[model samples]
Target: MHDTKVTTDVMNPDCIVIGYNEIDFAEHARRKRAEKGKSGGYHDLLTNSVLLGGERRTYMDLLNIVRERTTGCPSRLSAFELPSLGVAYLTSFLRRRGFSAAPVNSFNSATEQLREMLAGSPRAVAITTTYYVYDEPIQQIVRFVREQNPDVPIIVGGPRIQNLCSDQSPESRDGRLRPLGADIYINSTQGEDTLAAVLAALRDKGGDLSRTPNLIYRDPAAPDGPMLHTLTTVENNDLDENAVDWSYFDPSYYAPTAYMRTSRSCSFGCAFCNYPALAGPLNLSDLSTIEKELRYLCDHGVRNLIFVDDTFNVPLPRFKKICRMMIENKFDLKWISFFRCSNADDEAFDLMAEAGCTAVFLGIESGDQRILKNMTKFAKTDRYEYGIRELTRRGIATLASIIVGFPGETEESVKNTVAFLNRTQPTFYNVMLYYHDVLAPIENQREKYGIVGSGYAWRHSTMSWQEATDWKDYLVRNVNGPALMPGYGLSLWTLPYLLANGMTMEETVEFIKGASRLVIKGLDTDYLDPEPEIEEILRGLAAVRDGAGQGASS
Candidate 1:
């Protein structure tokens, strides 16, 4: 890590914030190992991953790889998109403030452009690391930046720092960010409003941090130690006001569909969730502003939209108003939204489809009542059935996001959930393996949830990783096969493009199920190199997902 230096005015004092991600097989395998808090030989990780079998590259991806190889040529098997909407707003706010700010948007763009931008030696380089797999790679990037330009203020933000703040002390916050090389840690509030204040502070010679909240400063006097500066709470709710520099983003950089968020946070206090801890509570964007955005997207020939709301169906009035507006405007755009079963009445689902929704994603955490109650999910399997079935009956495709290994999950619970899936047959399903965050309510209620172990090694009261993995494997083989959407189980993220381009809902689901999706993001440089070994690894995992091989633990 580099020594902390206060912001100095060396002229224009620009900031180039970048984000680095990995979808390459080797890089992805390394990240998976890091996430498990385990380290071993590279080949060993690949072998173990094939045996243990987490959600990975879809079966069709492997088939495509093999087919291309036989033709004596290779191409990129897939593409991954990390839209980094947070970074967009942050940099946009800086630009609007008269500071020279550049957003190196995508992972691919960062890799190719960051070094050059750094060579110019901007006043500061800012970036966001949003996921567990991103931490190490981002750390390496930050370290490299420090080596080249020791004086520049490196601002880092995102969930990793927030997770580190669980220690609940200023010194701990200081200590936690040392591993990362950021000069200022935006650990508290991530609103563009908050970041703009921080940026303005840093640009001033004295480095005024008075207006910032949840900020950890690097005091050169302390060097290795941090001086956590706690400021009064600031409501950074102007999220919808910030506009992205569309010139920085090329539609071709990501999937065919356009993405936007209508709001932040969910009202629910589900034990297993980290949403409230991260984003606080629901902060809806102005409905009038959203309508203008919808019209703009429509004017631009944008045909597919994805609503990234934490709970798009909640707060029934705003939800209904948005739906009514979409209907009134008669947007030709086909869209998909994340919905909770509690607010999913038949009338809502029916109105949603008439308003241009082609698919609805439901977070059906489990089919077992006990597991649902264990997490304070508030909604039960019967409720999931009604909402999902209503969408299915209404010709609106449904995708159920399922999770295994909740604190009280059991063999019977797995069996019951699988039975429920078999009976309902939602258009598709997203099977997630549970990982506990230190800040989540569930972690605090260890006894309440029967959580065992501690930190990264923890497990639920009755469930072991091996047991959960095996059960997850069983569910894939029996319940999910052949029901997935084609071409990477792109799910709602890319399904609108597929539908708009001509694929039917049934055709889309066919691609999503039966496929073990590759977890990392992919790029367009992107031509798949025919790695028969990679294909063979995928085939081996497919056999296990198809119930042919014993899991890694066995």
Candidate 2:
């Protein structure tokens, strides 16, 4: 650790903010293949198969398209999109306070960038570290800032940190979650206030941090202990579209549409979800204000937008009003958002599609209703199927996110999920492994329910008011695997049943193939949908089979 005594005046004059995007291991692996004159890696093969009906595209064509879209900034453009959303939000927030904040994608060279940025100005650096790939680089940047300019404060925050600080108990701590690192840990959902206070502290403006809420920092003298400040609650106001400084963003890096946070809390309290605890209850934005924001995005040439709400479909009337406004105003932009499957219906689905909704993501959680109820999801199986079918029939793409492992999960339940997927025929399906946290806040309740902790919880699990921690590593490496004896037998039994229902044998093969690709490529399978084109190819195969059968008969 570097010293923290150097003043910002003596150091660099500007405040530099660095956000990390992990090293593109997939790109590196692809280069290795090319050097050896080999064909595509897993990601390339998977994407090509899914998007292009398994037809191969030249590497040069792929590279050119990426270059055109990203403006030659970085080859790992897709990975940067999500991080860019956070950076964009923070960038606007920081600028509102009259501070200069630059969003840098501190790949592997974060330390060098920090050093250079600090050389010219007495600067403070803020970085968001998420997942394991970011750990070393962020630590390096923080250490360098402390060593080179000790007074320059380095602060870190993100979902990873919020999860790590959650409760960890023996019963709850399974090896599934990853921990986060940071000097000041702010676990509040409203990060703008905490971020503002940090900037004020750096400037010696001496703001009342007690009102800032969600600010957690270490007293420099005491390394092990952290001090938590009382959080401030801000009322939702109708924000003017012109209030945000959009000019600071690089057009190439920013998504075409802006992400707006319409609410701060969630209504449904799912056990696996940390949203309710982090964001608190749902506080909605004024429908008129939301309409204005949507108009602004469309005016700025954004053809697509995404709502970052924890549950965009909650408050059914409010959602309908927003939809009516979009339709009435003739807003032509397509959008997607997350929704709880249990809360949606045919009427809601029709209204959303009428308002240019292209897609909606559903957190289906599990195929087993018992698992759903156990997780406090409160999702009804019949309603979920109805909602899915209604949305699909209306030409609205439905993406189902399913979690595989839960405390009461058996192998039979997993097969039930596969069977459910076959029946739904959702446009996209995402399978997530169950994560276990060592010290979860809900540990005591585990005994109350007579349920033993899986020794793992998500980052949102806490003990005694601690924040959530991520357990991705443990979940992937330990909790998830092929089914065991009883489960395997159930899987065997369910395979034919699924095919008999609606899922073709080819689709089942594709699902397994896609899962294997994820393990090999470390790429998300959610975005891959090679099914439509693959279906056409399969039809041709069936035709050929029928022709051969006719010939044999003759």
Candidate 3:
């Protein structure tokens, strides 16, 4: 742990950005029970199981908890991983510009912390808010800064703010939907432009805000309460390498490895996702620029790199270019990134594996074609299976993501998902409870998929759109079988992967056989009542057994 530097009445820094960091994992556990209508005891049981079970905690459960809590209860809180990336990038970007910037987690004493930072007579403050849980804290932070130093400019950005800004136009009231507290609202796409403009303005003691992209502000002296600016959208490869200052920002804040975003935005517009809306179309940074960035990290001793791109494998040619550059440079680093299952092919998989790609997180979405089509995933079940198997055969590990409780989800659909996952057998999986956003732009045209009730209130304990669907019962009834939903079951499946990865080949096979048998037998007898159907399916998993058995036999 890095020791906190204590300074008495320290001069206010130039800028302070508040990032809502991860609270303890227990709070999320409690939220899950609240959303599921499970008893209080259930929370303790889960917390105990995860905290005490040690090796028993599965990736599926972690993802499920994230989805259920973020969806069912409209809190701005998110899993610790994503926000850490955003903070690292932003902090690094700011420090490179010669600005004293530090990313502070919201778990600390926020008010006092702000007061301490502002003591330096800083020029401005920026804070991030996600869709579900951050509105209130961000608003409060804005208000606190305003009350303390009325002239200090405050900027807000994140998925929630970006969506709100994107929906705003001459004819729409979406801009007004945002809390009136912020001096500026920035969309996600123009993060660098907006931050740079804000920094420039602060240095000059304020200037015309019109030049800033993806910003909205209010001038009390003018009749119009607020004015919005044209947002700047950069090309995929247009990242400003010189704009980032690395001195004040620390890369050591991350675990496993440092995080980097090789590209911005997503090409696919899955109806349930907000990325296309918030990020505004797919864009890739130039391969040379990405190579430069990767080399910089490697030179700086960053051995693990996690690309934060929503769809890393899209624009197959560009992806191949990146792979080639990585291999050519001999960038001795291991990386993990997300990919659309439909877009990956044998060549791409081979290149990635050769370049030391450790894992690829695939957004498999759902196993049912109808549900997938409804979600606009645009890929068939067969394609997904082929991709997973190919990746596995090539010795590159895979993490499949699945969504459950979507509008068209049914008992049969959930079962099919589990069966599909069982057949493909990725090394790891993540199951997300469905989250319906009525506030999303397409909600009016897609009301059937829109979440009902007062939608989720960010940062507050309230019912979210997914909760309106009675998802717990739906999941319990429809996805209750022994085979986990392709997405949901991955959590539990990862435990064996983790154990196996740490062992020798022979030991790994033995571990898998013993675990698989125990799991199969548990499923067979009705002893594990919650997953009986899964047990029945396991009885038919002779192929899976043979695969595991062969490795052991060899």
Candidate 4:
């Protein structure tokens, strides 16, 4: 941790902000194959493991290692096209406060480039750690930052920070925060105010953090011990004031797909989710504000938009008005959003497609009514069927997201989920293992369900965590596997990037399906170099992306 210094220059920058992008395994695998060739440890391990009776644990262990080492791996798709909107939001907020901020592109760039940027020696370096909870990449990033600027303050904040400090014990929270190797950690739900206060204190008061609430930092006086400064979260009500400054982004480093959020939190509180708690409350952007942002995005050449709203279709009136606004403006843009299957009117679906909604992500957690009730997911299974069918008839793609294990998961429920997927025929579907969190509402009923352990290692009365994982893999192998897209089972947000990069919906589905087949084959054989096949598919897609680019330029 760095000490408080009086060397901040307002003209240079208040700080340099960066965000971690998720690793695209297909891209990672392709890079590894190029660097190591087809005859490396990765291939040898798989071949040897298969010859010696394939051990699933060994294969999984290797994959985990690959995920850890694949940090800083650039992607032509996710990295450049889908940059972190969280970083953009914070940077825009800081700039609005008259604090010059340099937003670093950590997605498609390397750490050494960050080292070059640190030559400016800004007041502090802020890193956004959200989405996946994997800390290995974060640890690597923190180490790189220290190497670049030994004495500069490092501030970490995001939804993931809330998860890291969720434990009531100070020691546990300190243990987690300290390992990230940052001078300051923001543990607030909404961090705009907390972060702004931190910057102001660091700059004007020589890093006096007493005024900054919701922070974990080492006291300047007591250098040996870390201190927690806690307070009630002050939510940001006026989101309209902070429009993203597109000037901070490099057009060459980004694609035409832009991510926008029309709301702050979800209206419903599902038992297994902690987002509602983290986001404070549900606050919708005014329709005027939404239109202004939409116009600004169009001016910046955004041909496609992805609304990162928790529930975009809720408070149905607002949803209808937004759709009508896009239609009235005649903006040449396609969009997508998360939709609740219930309480939706038939006219809404027609308006959605007419307003250029190419896709909708349905969080249909389960097709079993028993599991839905257990999850407090108010919507019925039948409503989900109707919603998907309605979207399908209107030519809108439906990505049905499924969770394998909740408190009451059973084989019968899993069967029901599979049957529902088969019947609805969603354009895409993904099954994920339940991520158990002690802070989630479901924790209140842990004893009733006989829940034990935490995170991906948890178990309940009905099944163990391993059973859930195995069931997840089974669903991937069977449940409409041939029809649904593959390469994006983990990251559904990347689908819009494909559409923006000049791939037709049919072409995108066919391309990902080809990759999905190899994935399924690997599961069946337990041994095979599908990465080489995956690399070929990516190469083809890259050509299409490039060809589209050349044509546009012409």
- Which is the leading candidate under TM-score? 4
Ranked candidates, highest TM-score first: 4, 1, 3, 2
Off by over 4 Å in 4: 1-11, 21-75, 107-112, 228-233, 245-255, 481-490, 524-526, 531-554
lDDT leader: 4
Q: Write the per-residue lDDT of candidate 2 for residues 1-554, one digit (tens) a residue.
A: 11111122323433465665444343433443353222112222322222222233222233223334434454322223332445566666677667666555444434565566676654466776543322555565566667776765666766655565455442232221212234565554455557766777657654334455555655566545444435544433223432344455543343354445677678876775555765556777888778776776666656556677778888888888888899998888677788766776667877899998866777887777887877787778777788888887888766667665565666566666766767777666544555443333344456544443342222222221011111221222232222111111112222323332334434433443433333323333324344443344345445555666798899
How good is model 1 by TM-score? 0.79
lDDT of 1 by residue, 1-554 (tens): 00111132222346775654544444565455565433122212221122113333444355345435545666333223434555555555676677666666554545545555666758777777754433666676677777767777888776667677755676666666777767787765454555666767766746767556767777766766547575746455565675444333444432345677778778888887777767876788888878887776676566778888888987887888899998889887778888887776777877888888887777788889998888888887888888877887878877777776778889899899899888888877766666676667887888776777643355666886656665766666567432533222244566665555444554344333323332221211122333434555445434544442254346
Off by over 4 Å in 1: 1-13, 23-25, 30-83, 147-150, 206-213, 225-232, 243-256, 480-491, 496-508, 514-554
- Candidate 3 residues 163-261, lDDT tens each? 555545743533443464777667545575467667887687455677665566665366255455555555232564632333343344442255577
TM value for model 4: 0.83
Question: Which lDDT tens digits does candidate 4 get at residues 130-247?
Answer: 6646575566677777877788888988877788887668888887777777888888777877888888998899888876678888776775686656664666747777766555
RMSD of 2: 12.3
Show the lowest summed lDDT stretch of 10 residues, model 3.
1-10
Report lDDT (Cα) of residue 335, candidate 3. Answer: 74
- Deviation (Å) of 301 in candidate 2: 1.9
lDDT of 3 at 126: 78
Off by over 4 Å in 2: 1-14, 24-76, 105-116, 129-137, 140-151, 166-183, 205-257, 437-444, 448-554
Model 3: lDDT equals: 0.56
Number of colliding residue pairs in model 3: 27
Give lDDT: candidate 2, residue 307: 75
lDDT for residue 415 in candidate 3, whole number 0-100 = 69
